[model samples]
Target: MFKIKSLVFIFLVFYSTINYAQFTDVINSNRPGQSMAAFSVGKTVIQAELGINRIIEKDKDVDYKAAIWNSDLALRYGVFFEQFELIANLEYQNEKFTAPGVDIHEGALKKVLIGAKYLIYDPEKNYEKKPNLYSWKANHKFNWRQFIPAVGIYGGVNANLAKNKFLRGSDIPRDEDFTLKGMILTQNQFGRYTFLTNIILDKFPSQRNSIDYVLTMTRGFNDRVSGFLEIQGFNNEFYKDHFLRTGAAYLVRQNIQVDASVASNFQASPNIVFAGVGASWRFDANYNEVMLRVPKEEKNDGKSKKEKKDKEKKDKEKKKRKDAVENTEFK
Candidate 1:
C-alpha cells in the first residue's frame, strides 16, 4: 500500500511538471514575475510561507539577470482527539529589485493554512521495538505498542498581488500583475514510528501548477527527547529543488518545549546555515500556548514540579518498606 501511494504521488508530480512546461516560453519571454504565499492549518500543526521571484529584462538590454527573494515562517500545534483538531498558520514575504534605473516591486501573501485531521483505521496492535536517531541513552528503545493509522486530508486557498514598473527614455509602458492561488496538503502517519508522508499541490493565477512531496521520520528518545528529519521535493517546469532538515526537541517541562534545527538546500541558491531557539508554554489549554522561555532555560528544566513530587513519593515509600522489614526481622 505504501509503495502504491508513493508511485501515485511521483506520477502526479511529473504530470504537473509536464503541464507547466507548455507555458514556459510564455512565462519566460514576457519577463513575468511571480510571488507566492501559503498557509496551512491541520489537526496537529500550523505553518505559513511567502516567496517572490522576478526576471528583469527590457528591450535592447543584453545583460539581463533574474532576481529572487523568499521568506517562510511556520508553527505546529499537536492535538489528539477522536473527531478532529484545528491548526492555524500565517506567513509573509517581499521581493524587489531594479536594473538600469528601472524600479520593480513584487510581493505576495505567502501563506494562510487552516484544516483538520480525522481518525481512521486505528487498529490495536503491537510490534517489536526499534532504534531511534535521537535516543539519548544507548540502551533506550520503543516498541510499537499501539497502532493507529489515521487518514485525513487538509487544504486551503489564498490571494497573490504584485506591482512592477519600468522606465525607458520617459516613453515606456508599466506592467501590473495580480494572481490567486489554491493549495492542498494531505498527510498520513502509521503507528508510532513508521512511514510519514505529505502530498502538496497548488494552482497559480497564471495557470501554473506545482506539486511537491515531503517525507519525514520521527524518533523518540526516552520520554523527554525526540528527533526528526525531513526531506522535501518540489517539481515544476521552471525549477526543481530539494531540501533536507534535521531537528531535535526536548520537553523542558509539562507545558514547555525547546527545539532547534539545521537546514540546507541542495541547490545553488543558498545553503541555509541557521539555528533557532524556540519554546512554548501552555496557560489554560494546551492549544492556547505561547512561546515563553529561551532554548537554554527550557533545555535545563524539562521536569516539572509534579514529576519531582512523584519521584520523592516513590523514594519515601521504598524507605518505609525497608524500615518495616528491618523492624520485623529484629523483633
Candidate 2:
C-alpha cells in the first residue's frame, strides 16, 4: 500500500513541475526550502507555514514507515534598530511510528525557538539609499540581494516540549531537551538565482555538541515562482551525516506561498525517500513602519514627484483664499 502511494505521489510531483516552472518562497519561513534567507522578516511582519513529511524504508528483514505533521509559525519584530530583528517560532509536531509488529502514534508541541538576527552588512546599491521617514507603504522594488553576499548573525535557544511522547518509540537521534545554537548566515543573488549558506554550532549540555552546514540555491522562473536545490551536512562528537534535497515553490499572492519537496540520504539508504508539502504566509502589521523598504533609486524618484505635487496643491489653496477675500471686499 505504501509503495503504491509513493509511486502515485512521485508521478504527481513530476507532473506539477513540468507544468508549472515558477516557484515562491522566503527564507523567513524556511519551509519547502532549505536555505534561511539572509534578510530579516522585516519590522512588524509574521510568517507561518505548515507541512507533512513521510519517510519509508522497506527491506526483506525490516520494514519501517514514519510520518510527521508539522506546523511552523514565526514572527520577526524589528526592535531598537532597523538592522536588528527579534525572532520567535513555534513548531507543533505529530508523528506516527510503524515497525514490524507495532504502531505508535504521538502528538505534542515539539519546540519553541526564540532568537535575534542582526544584519551586519548589505552592499546592494538600493540598500545604500535610505527611505525618507514618511514612506509608510512598502517599496517592493528594493532588494538587499546583490552579487556579494549579505551577512547576518543569529543566536537562539530551543525549548523542547514533547513530553517524552515520541522519543520512546522513535529511532532517530535528536538533540537534548534544551539546546543552544549560534549561526552565521550569508546569502547572495546572481541574476534571478539566490544562494544562501548557514554555518551553525549546537551545544547540548546534556548531549554531545554538533555542528551543521546548509547550502541552498534557488532559481526563479519569473516574479511569482522559484525552485531550489539544497545540501546539508552534520558533524558531532559521535556521528557524521549528509543529505541532498530539491523542491519547488509557488506564490499564491503577495503574502502567501506553497511548496513541495523530496529528499533522500546522500550516502546510505538509497531506497529510502522523504517527501513533504507545505505553505507559508507573510503579512505586514498595521503600523507606521514595516518590512520592504523602497529602493534608493526609486526612493529618490518618488520623493521628487511627491514634493512637486505638494507644491502645486499648496499654491492652489493659497490662490483660492486670496481670490475669496478680494471678491468679498469689493462687494
Candidate 3:
C-alpha cells in the first residue's frame, strides 16, 4: 500500500511538471468523446475536470424517494514526444432520501477508468476565413460547420473498478463491466462557430454481442463559451435504450471551463430527471507562455506539421555534413 501511494505521488509530480500545450477537454461533456483536437497537448500539459449532479427518483406508490449526488472526475496527461495522451477517471456517488424516515443512505467511490489515446491520423487542415453566404434564408449568416471537416481517430479502454459493496440490487453504473471503445472525431468552424462531432462504439466483454453507440455534437459560441446536443443508445440488439442531453460551457481563458447540463431516461418510471454542473481546469508548468505565444495551427499553408518536421531534420543533417567536411580539412 505504501509503495502504491509513493508511486502515485511521483506520477503526479511528473504530471504537473509538464506544460499546457493544447485545449482542455470539450465543454458540456457528459462522457469523454473520441474527438481528438488537431494538436496534442504539449508534453508539459496536465488537465482535470470535475462534475457534480443530483438525481431524483420516486417509487410508483410515491412512498419512497431517493436523491443521489453523483460526482464525475477525469484527469489527462500529455506525452508530447508522441501524439499520445494518458487519462484517468474516478466517480463518486452519494445517495439518500430527501423524505423523512428513510433508512437507505449510502455514498462511496463507484467507478475508475485508466486509458490512453494515440492520434493515429490527423489531417492538419485549416479553413480560410470566409463569409456566411446563406442563399436559402434572407438573414442566415454562414459558419464554420459549412466547410469541409478535419478528422481525427482515437481508441481507448475504460477499466472497471467497482467495489463489491457498491454493486448490489438495482444499483449498477453504465460503465460497470470492462469496456473497450473507439471513436471518430471531426469538426469545422463557421466564423466563431465551431461544430465538433463524434461517433463512438463501445463493446462489453461480458456481453460480446452487445454494442453501444454515443453520437455527440458540440457548438462553440466563441473561444470562451460552447454548447452541446447528443443522442446515445444501443445498436443492433433485442434491447435498445436512447437518451438525449443538452448543455453549455463557459471558458475561463484557455485553461479553465465551467459547464452544466440536464438529461433524463425517457422511458424511466416516475419521470425522474438528471441535472449536473461541472468545471475543468488545465495546468502545466508553462501554461502562460505557451497559451499566449503559440497558435494550435502553426503555418497552415496546407503543409502538415510532419512535413515541416522532416524538412527541419534534413536541414540539420546537411549542416552537420558541411561542418564535418570543414573539420576534416582543418585536421
Candidate 4:
C-alpha cells in the first residue's frame, strides 16, 4: 500500500511538471539571428551566445570604403520566474577606412546593452489542442488560434561608451552617455516552421533615436539542423536601410549550438555586406522545476465512477489497517 501511494505521488509530480513547466529538455538560445525569441530560458538557467563578423561597406556619396571586424557576446539568465529573463549584450569593432588620399585604422566598443524580458502571454498554457479522432479533415483543418503568437516585452538601457567609432559623423546628435531601448517580441510555430518578429525602439529622446524591426522565419530540416531567413530594417531620422539575411544553425549537443549567417543591404550609396559565425552554450545545472496546478476538469484520467469507488474503498481499508497497527503499537 505504501509503495502504491508513493508511485501515485511520483506520477502526479511527473505529469504536472511536464504539463505546466516552460523549461525545455534542450537548451533554447537566440543565436545566428538578430531577433529575440519570445520564450525565456527556464528558471535558473544561464546561457552565453558569442559571434564574430566581417563587414564591408562602400558609400557612393562620400566616396569612402570601410572594412570592419566585429565581435559580440550576449549573456542571458532566467531568474525570479520562468517567464522572465535578464540579458546583457556587448559588441566591439575594429575598422579600416580608405578614401581618396585618406586612410585610417580604428577600434572601439560599438554598444553595450543590459535588459530584461518578460513573457506576457503564452497560448499553450492551460490549453491543449487534441486531435479529432472521428475525422481526419477536422484534425488537419486550420485553426484561428494559430494566429495568436506568444508575446514578450523587453526593456533595456544602452551604455554610450567613450570613443565609439560609429557615433562619430552621424547626423543626429548624441550628447548623452546612456540611452533607452525597448522591444516587443512575438513568435509563432507551425509544425517544422517558426516565425519571429521584433519591434524595437532605441536611443530614446536623442536625435539619433530610431525604430527598428526584425522579421525572421526559420524551418527545421531535422532534429539537429535548421535554417533561417531574416529581414531587418532601421528607421531613423538620418538613416534608413533594410537588410536581407540568411543563416543556418546546427545543434552540437542539448546545450550547445553553432551557426553562420550572411547579410546585405540594397542601398548603393552605402552598400553594406557582412558575414558571421556564432555559437551558444547553456548552463542549467542550477535549474529547478516548478509545477503548476492542473485544471480540475482536466484531472479526470478517464476512470469510471465504479472504478473510483473501488479505489476509495481500497484506500479506506489501507488507512484502517495503518491506524490499527499504530494503535496496537501504542498499547
Candidate 5:
C-alpha cells in the first residue's frame, strides 16, 4: 500500500511541475526568461506549501515506480528590535508503492526554531560619499561587516497511526521516530557585495544523518533589489551519498521572491532540476509623535484660581464657628 501511494505522489508532482511551467511562461511574457527572486524577512508571517515528485520506468524484464508528496504549514514571529525570530512548523508526507502492496508513511509537528541576526554595516551609506565612482564601477567594493554568527536548533518526534485491519492485526506495529536539526549562518560585506555562508546538520528517525554547506555572493542592485548566486553541497551519511546544488535568487519586491536551482548526485540517484517561488509580507508601519508647547500662565491659571477660592471659603467658615462657641460659653 505504501509503495503504491509513493508512486502515485511522484507522478502527480511531475505532472504539476510541467503544467506550472507552462502557466508561468504565459504570465511572465514580458520577462526575458524564468527568473527567481530572493527571500526576505517579516515581523509576523504564515506560510503554507505543497509539493510533489514522481519517476516511473517500465520494461519487458524490469519495472520501477516512485512518488512523493509533501505538505507543510508554518508561522514565524520576530522580536528584539526585529533582529531575532522564532518559528514553528507542521508537516505531512505520503509515499506509496504499487508493484508490491506496501505502504510507508509519517507525519509530525515538524520543528520549532529560534534565530538572531545583526546588521553591522551598510554600503549604501558610503555610496552617498562617492556617488560618481561607485555608480560607474561595475563591481563595487563595500565595507566588511559581520553578524554575530549564531546557530538555530530544533527537535521533534512523530508516530505512525495508520490502521491495517484488512491485514492481520498483528502485522501492524506502532512505531515512533525522532528528528533534530541545527543551522548556523553568517554574512559579511566588502563594498557593494556581501558574502554569506551556512552550515546545517539534520538527523532523521530512520537513523540517517545529513550535513550541508552553502556559500553565496550577494550584490545589492539598489535600495529595493538584490541578487545572489549560491553553491551548496550535502552529504548523507546513512546512504553514503553526496549531492550538490547551484542556484540564484532575485528580489522583485519587498514581499515577492523567486528561486531556481539544479541539483546533481554523487553515489546516489540521478541528477534532477528543481525551481521554487516564495513570497513574504511584513505589515510593519512607522509612526512619528509631535509635541506642542503652551504658555505656563495659561496652563496653571484656571485650576490654581479655583483651588485658592475654595481654601479661603473653608477658613472663613471655621472662624465663624469658633466665634459662635465663645458666645455660647459667655451666655
Candidate 6:
C-alpha cells in the first residue's frame, strides 16, 4: 500500500539540470492553512480547494462581540510550464455583531485575488538523497543540507469590492480599490517532517501596508493521514496579532483530500478564534508526462584507422575461407 505523505509544500523530481518535477501520484494541496506551496500542479492539470469556517471575535476595547461564517475557494491551474501556476481565490463572509442593546448583521465578499506563482529554486534539482543500504545509522543521521529549502515567488492583485465590510474596518482605509500583494514561499522536507514558511507583503503602497508571515510543520502518520501545526503573524498600522493552528488531513483518494483545523490568536485586546474544514480535488486527465532526453555520444578508444581496416579485412577473409570449405564439402 502506498501512503500519501504530507504533500502540502515543495516535493519535486529533478531531471537533467533544468527540470523541476510537477504533480504526484496523489493530489498535492495547500489547505487547512493559509500558506502556499512551492510546487505547481502538473501542466494542464486543474485543481480546486474549498473551505468554510466559523469565526468568533471579542473586542474589549470596542465593547463588541461577533460571530462570523466564511467560505473560501481557490482555483489553481498549471499553465505554460510545470514550474508555473495561475491561481484565483474568492471568499465570502456573513457576520453578526452584538453589543449592549445593539445587534447588526452584514454579508459581503471578503476577498478576491488573482495570482501566479513560480518556483525559482529547487534544492532537490539534479541531486538525489540515496539511503545507505548497509548502515541504518547513516540513513538516520542528520544531514546539514536539509536546511536548504526550495524557494518560490508569488504576486497577485486583490480586488477590494464595494460593501466589503471585512476589508473596510474602522482602522483600515477603503480608498484603494486594488492592491498588490507579494509573497516569498519556502519549503523543506526530510524524513516524515515537512517545514514551510511564507513571508507576505499585502496591500502594498496603501495605507494598510500589512506584513504577514506563516510557519507550518507537518508530519505524516501513515499512508492515509497527516497532521500539521501552523503559526501566523500579522502586523500593520492598525493591529498586530499571532495565531496558532493545528489540523489533520485524510486522503480519500489519489485525487481527493479532506482536512479540518482549529485556530486562535494569542491576544486579549481583541481575541479571535476559528475552526474550518476543507477539501481539495484535482483533475489531471489532460496532463502528459514531460521527460528529459540526453543525446547518446559515440565513444572513441583511440584505435588507428589502419588497425580497424586490417581487423575488418581479416574477418572478411575468414568468412570467405569458411564459405569455401562449406562449398567443397557439399561437392
By TM-score, who's the top model here?
4
lDDT of 6 by residue, 145-171 (tens): 978988999999988874446542554
Indicate the residue-level lDDT of 224 in model 5.
41
Total clashes for model 1: 13
- Off-target runs (Cα >4 Å) in candidate 2 are 1-29, 57-65, 100-102, 125-147, 168-175, 269-272, 285-331
RMSD of model 6, in Å?
7.7
lDDT of 4 at 187: 80
Query: What is candidate 2's TM-score against the reference?
Result: 0.66
The runs of at least 3 residues in candidate 1 whose Cα sits more than 4 Å from the true structure, single-residue gaps closed, are: 1-81, 94-109, 124-148, 161-194, 204-206, 269-277, 280-331
lDDT of 5 by residue, 61-165 (tens): 223233434333333343433223444444344443333464444333322222233322222222212234446563344523233222222233332223222
Each model's TM-score, in the order given?
Answer: 0.45, 0.66, 0.60, 0.83, 0.45, 0.80
Against the hidden true structure, what lDDT does model 4 obtain?
0.75
Give each prediction's root-mean-square deviation over alpha carbons: 16.2, 10.4, 11.9, 11.4, 17.9, 7.7
Positional deviation of residue 304's Cα in model 6 after best superposition, in angstroms: 24
Report the lDDT tens digits of candidate 4 across residue range 119-210.
Answer: 89887676756666799999988878867898999999988784445543645465468899999998877666778899989878687788
lDDT of 3 by residue, 1-331 (tens): 0000000000010111123323333322223222334344545567777777777765454455677777877777777543567767677777775445546677766666566655544333222333335654434544333566645565666555544333323433333456776666664544434455556565444343245544456655655666766555555333455556677777665555677777665554344567877776667665333332223343465457798899889999999999999999999
| True-vs-predicted CA distance for residue 254, candidate 1, Å | 2.0
Comparing 4 and 5 by lDDT, which wins?
A: 4
* Whole-model Cα lDDT of every candidate shown, in order: 0.37, 0.60, 0.52, 0.75, 0.34, 0.76
Which is the leading candidate under lDDT? 6
lDDT accuracy of residue 318 in candidate 4? 100
For residues 123-180, could you state the per-residue lDDT of candidate 2 as single tens digits?
5423444455666565445543455776889888877777556553244455577788
Clashing pairs in 3: 18-44, 19-44, 19-45, 132-142, 143-190, 144-189, 144-190
